[model samples]
Target: MSVEHDKALAAKGRHIALVIAATMLGWLAMSLFIGPALGLAGRYALLFDFAALAGFIYAAVNIFQLWRMRQDSQR
Candidate 1:
């Protein structure tokens, strides 16, 4: 049981890390290239910013959950 729980935690951690990395990189790419290439206005760029913000928030919540799970498991 403990082994399975640990594995699940590891998987969750990896997923959260991936989400954070992807959000940052994707936001950078869109802001730098896609937006300018498409000639998006400032308001339109905010859409991407908002999307990135959501992704980061999701990752943060998941990370907190994972931390709590780890703490409980340790105890």
Candidate 2:
């Protein structure tokens, strides 16, 4: 493979890693802070709901990636 190809692949990998890490951290931070604060704000606020929705989205994404990795491994 060409040097350019290698550099591109590395760059792509780095980007993906950064995104995944950030999402994971965001989920963690929200769960720890905004989630509970919203929950304590009585039954009208949507902070907890937002956290739940974000958790589901991130979980789905991570699961999809895992499934894809499994598929690739099977090949």
Candidate 3:
């Protein structure tokens, strides 16, 4: 592959990593503060917890994808 193509791939990977990290931080903040500050009751709070878990799972997947991209680029 050409230098420009490699550079573009690296740039894209960096952008994806930054966006995913920001999203994960937002979810972390929401789970830690916003969810409880709303004063949700038992079941509602449970639902919110599940939503937070989903967000974490999504972030994990994105992180794995980033790792895979880096590994492939090294090859």
Query: Which structure among the candidates has the greatest TM-score?
Result: 1
lDDT of each residue in 1-75, candidate 2, tens digit only? 457655755665565566666766776666667757666554423554566567667656766665565466556
Residue-wise C-alpha lDDT for candidate 1, range 5-64, written one tens digit per residue: 979998999999899999999999999899999999988689999999999999999989
Error of 3 at 26 (Å): 6.6
Pairs of residues at least 3 apart in sequence or in different chains that clash in candidate 2: none
> How does each model score on TM-score?
0.93, 0.51, 0.55
Ranking according to lDDT, highest score first: 1, 3, 2
Residues 1-75, candidate 3: write the lDDT tens digits: 568767866776676667667666765666667767886565765665577567667757766776776677678
Residue 30 in model 3: lDDT: 64
Candidate 2 wrongly placed segments (more than 4 Å): 38-75
User: How high a TM-score does candidate 2 get?
Assistant: 0.51
Candidate 2 vs candidate 3: which has greater TM-score?
3
Query: In lDDT terms, how accurate is model 1?
Result: 0.93
